[model samples]
Target: MSAVSPRPSYAAVLRIPHARRTFAAALTARLSYGVVPIAVMLCVTRATGSYAVAGVVLAVFGATVVFLSPYRAALVDRYGPRRVLLPMALLYAVLLCTLTVAGRHPGASGLLLGVIAAVTGACAPPLGPTMRTVWRELAEDRLLLQRAYSLDGVAEELLFVTGPLLVGVLVGFTAPAVGVVLGAMLMGVGTPAFVMSPAVGAMRGSGGVRKGRRASLRPGRELLPPIVVAGGVGLSLSAVDLLVVAFAGQRRLGDDTVAWVLAALSAGSAVGGLLNGAVDWRTPARVRLPFLAAGLGVTLGVAGLAPGVVTLTGAAACAGLFVAPALTTAYLIADEAAPAGFRTQAGAWVNTSVNAGSSAGAATMGLLVERLPLGVCFLVAGGVSVGAAVIAGI
Candidate 1:
């Protein structure tokens, strides 16, 4: 056997021709993941003057887009990214434009706007997962793949933070609808470029990859365990997010400070992800995955009990450190566990599960905070983390 070469760094990884374009595309696509909510909120507020209406509208979009993913991903597998994504990207753009027009026109019906948001979002490009799939195909080694996933997690943290910041900037500089429109325009550019990339064209696929059919509607049982773990992770993350907000409110920190505090949590995660990428694990993924996940929960549980802002910051950082490693392990394992020719479906299910969990987290913690102390909300966040650990362990 030939000797193996060292895995490429994230910077070097991007220097590959197709990788650069797809990486850029993935950033925009994933950026939209966070951008859409704020954009929708701002658009609705500008048009209807009701944040409640905007929240409801955005919630509908989030709920719809997630559940529809498996089907959409199946299409990508069936027709390939070019045929499927091009149309979806076009439709998504049209919908955003339509939404902008509807919001600006007082004569436009709310029902029409809701329909636009729901359908447009449901059909949005599967940018994040698609990029992961492409990266796996392009990776030179398992270690490289793991590094790619860590880089993905890091990008996700930055995208989420940056997405809202960009939206706020757009809203300040232009009409509220401008943010949504700008997001859609970026999608229009990125999706087509990603699909048509010469690099994507050269990647080899297993002959088993084929068109999805009605009979293929259900994913293989191999996916069940990891998807459950992913959902739990998603749920725990959402709970932690809300709990942080509640913590900030309790400490008499203004809205302006909330982002600063959350930045500490995100910064820790980025560092952890970077370190994970640099290390080569000798342990089995099954053992490593659950261990990291459970360790995360334990850390979060202890941190939730912190009595002051300084303690809370340190605790959040401790919890944050585990976030990317667990996620990277889960993704790697899920890819291994996916059935033949069904990796896309498996990825979609993972996405769906996490999303479902996040929805539950928001709703569950929202209710808890209404009747229980803010500390209780933090405890619940920790509990959810533990629950994720258990599900992943099993």
Candidate 2:
């Protein structure tokens, strides 16, 4: 008689010795990323008393973070996270504190703030990619690895949502600089805890630096599909935010109504992420990725045709369903394609693609909304995603 294989579960992923501890510590550090953005923006705005300066400062920060991400990840790959992460986190935390102190007084120099923000961005640790690399090491079984990625993705989504809300609550009582200080504390405390984990300790003995130095820096052709699809997914999702706002405005709905619609999108993504992880699919991840991207594209296109807010919310929810699964699959593919000693950098490329695409999408959609019909803008955004999928398939 054939033996029945154990079904892969999230509990099983955590049950792997050290996984729970390591993941928890990583999440603690990652939460700082979610908190820092809004906190920094608010602090800058308060200091400069000009939204224009605040916007430029935030843009400089984001540009550095997004563009330098892969290089940061490469450092982790070469030096190993245990040896590298703590120092990076410390520098990052110190910079945040410095920024807080400098931006506390009104009429703070915008140029100085921009310089500090840029330096802070450059020093930001690649904790997310490093954690994903640790996950790859812990979950040797393919199915279990899928679950780990899905759970990580869902938790990350929640962190970003909660981080902004947390900042909102804190600013009601304290200054915005306090929120920035809070983020610094999280990073200062969390990185040491993460690096001390036994899982990370194991990596220290592997001589990743020597191996990483020998590995080619350029990503191979196999990585193209995931990277391209990830960029497309980011572009479409970013554009959806503006499109929804416009959709609400055209119908005379208030900003509160727009929140509810966006809430549906988040709800759908969380549910879809959980479901994607739970299933034991026969199809390979590479085979599954393009189809997932296409599903998102079609749903987003249909969202443009919604006659009412309710229908639009439903369409957005449908689009959200594909968001997590597609990105998760993209990460999985990138991991598979990565060379030995290069896993962190491989993951960072996918991450950088998503963020860079988001910046572009937001700018493009802003212009399109002024000149084109809302429905047409949606079509253009969706079409970008579909085109990416087609390119990946070919």
> For residues 130-189, what per-residue lDDT tens digits would candidate 1 score against the true structure?
777787777758878878888987898788888888898887778878888877887887
Total colliding residue pairs, candidate 2: 0
Residue pairs in candidate 2 whose N, alpha carbon or C atoms collide under 3 angstroms = none
lDDT score, candidate 2: 0.89
Over 4 Å off in model 2, which ranges? 1-6, 205-216
Worst 10 residues of 1 by lDDT: 207-216
> Which 10-residue span in candidate 2 carries the lowest summed lDDT?
204-213
Off by over 4 Å in 1: 1-6, 106-108, 203-221
State each model's C-alpha RMSD to the native.
3.2, 2.5
TM-score of 1: 0.92
TM-score of 2: 0.96
Superposition error at 197 for model 1 (Å): 1.1
